[model samples]
Target: MSAGASGVGGAISAHGLGGAKDLPIPSELAIAGAVAALVVSFTVLAVAWREPRYDAATSGRPAPAWLDRLVSSRALAVTARVLGMAFFLYVAAAAVFGQDSLINPFLGTFYVLLWVGIVPASLLLGPVFKAVSPARTISMAFAKVSGVPEGQGLYAYPARLGYWPAAAGLFAFVWLELVYPYSTDVGPVRLWCAAYLGIMFIGSALWGTTFLERADPFEVYSSLVAKLSIWGRRDGVLVLRSPLANLDTVVPRPGLVAVVGVLFGSTAFDSFRESTPWLQLVQSLSGSRVWPDTLALIAFSAGVALVLTIATMATGVTSDTPRRALPDLFAHSVVPIIVGYIVAHYLTYFVEYGQQTLIQLSDPFSRGDNYLGTADLQVDYWLSSHPTFLAVTKVLAVALGHVVGVVAAHDRAIKLLPPRHQLTGQLPLLAAMVCFTVGGLYLLFAA
Candidate 1:
């Protein structure tokens, strides 16, 4: 019933590409993952360092001077921007000029490469979007022409606005992808991208690059995931930090909880909508699924934000920081969970369709051009044929994400909570994380 998959079986699918799905994982494996999550949560709480281990101001060692020079070089920055812009223009050309058939590269490039592929790309290279953001590039040119200095706008970006704009932008994109029926239609999808582009330009014009940093959904998501990468900066110098240590450096800001919620919730909803129970329910209802799916998406996102708020705020707090702030403070903990769900849900779509996209890229006009030498390339279906390996990989990814999240939350809790309440404070959050992990596992198994 959802736009992602046809009501019955057909060529249309959530991603442009679809094939045999991995069978439901064994129930025993799901149970084991849930149990492992519990064990890891408590183990970290009981035995992990009592004192706070990560301090952004003091953590991480500087990179090798040559490496730093390479990373920070103007030539490298210019090249990244040029490449990103080139790719964007190439895809935009296809979207604007190509046939509206399923084979068009735009859909896969947008939904698969840009959306799903950003995670792994940012994992290896920190904040790839921010570095190569076409909007940022254009904004910089505008500022220079207007005689404005870099990083400054007509007025300062409101501190209170924080990441809320980015959260809303993220929600908008997910709603379009997951709930809108015409998401696969090139025109609607193109319009959505154009709107996103307009917003980025206008917001940057008004609030400067700071607005883009906190308002561009892709930038915010990529930058946040980049925190889990080894690359970091201290005093404007490139340095490397452990993932845990780097994660702890995330600045708590307004609406961070909602950002994570939309991310995790939307992925969860993707799985839920594809499951048979929900599909049959939608089939029985027999109207447009737009309203139902929209409501469900809202519920899933709000539910996560609600759970996170109650879980983090349930603990006792010191006068130094209010309990209400704990949600954003601990929001970084769930970044790993988001990454996990992304891996579990989109791994096949990304790797498989990503290749297909490269192939299509060579023939952007659907003219059989093979310009990039990719049209002749064959997409390997090795993962699709190997269901067991795929299933185990999904379960393992979810468990590992939960484990990292638990440890992150534990570290943050101890650092913030009063001594008497430290251990007790984490219990509720721990329970909440377990439920999330188990729920995620169940969805992956059943979906």
Candidate 2:
């Protein structure tokens, strides 16, 4: 089995089925596979650089008839839609009925399991999410409300509105979820869910049938990802697709595994960082040294960025591969990234303010205090006690992580895309990294 698969299997066996003490170190075989993936990624880049038109297979007419047929099948699309919607409904219900305690161990564990197991499995099986996405269902509902043909006219828009605005709106919603997780509470969650569905139905009616036909950002992103897979074909060959497609091709699966591992692991690490007084004592010994503080902060941020980037890239790449066709890559990436950030950012609170806040809110029957009553007050208290320098360091750390993640992503893109497109995709990412680095330094020193 692949290293990614093995790591997943091991994690499942250890965490899912076995006790924490029974957890095993990642197998050596898995590490080797990860290394091999990196090697293959570089190899593809080198070859693509030398021969732009190099063909690995003699049969050079677009991918085999079977591959095209499989992707285009309407039955496959319907199945994916059903599955995606089902999963969303299940999670939504769990979140609402089970309360805060349901967020972890139950909902959280299920989410992880689906990503590692179901998502990957769908690449070979079909577009799993497409079969059952809440978003799609909402859109269909909106179509009905707006008097548009059912599922036919939901995406119509003028060129002036552009895809970016829609993309930005989606991103904004995700950011809110990440930055303010309370938005997912039972009442708010249901309201937002209904609102989204209403919007889709209205949009479809106003825009005519063409609205529903409009290309979604998620679909576009997925196509780009699918183009980068080893199974991606411009011709009947196993060669890389667009030279610009390099970002998605390199040791795709292992890269994905690493991203997920780091995200979850870092959150755990942060929890330990906050909860472990011994570690705090060790940190205190550094006495606010710029180097150690900066390093710690940067590591934290980079961990998050890496996780988000990998998850986004993976969704983009694998959406149309032999494995699966995930149409809601945008939503999937947004939800997890935002949720993870909220959890990580609040780690300190969970530790320091536990007795006063989280512990109480987590209890379903608590009557003396509520989230807004005692919990918010405790957060204010903890905030007052935290050192200004610590906050500064944390911000710097986040900036550094973004820089590292952008660079890593750029490197992958440069190696995958054609030489011409290499600079196009990579330059922006590089510029962003530079800007983040400069901003971080300024924050570190100016504060």
lDDT of each: 0.84, 0.37
TM-score of each: 0.95, 0.40
Q: Model 2, residue 281: what's the lDDT?
A: 68
Best by TM-score: 1
lDDT of 2: 0.37
Runs with alpha carbons beyond 4 Å of true place in candidate 2? 1-64, 95-131, 137-156, 181-184, 208-227, 230-447
Off by over 4 Å in 1: 1-24
Alpha carbon deviation, residue 392, candidate 1 (Å): 0.9
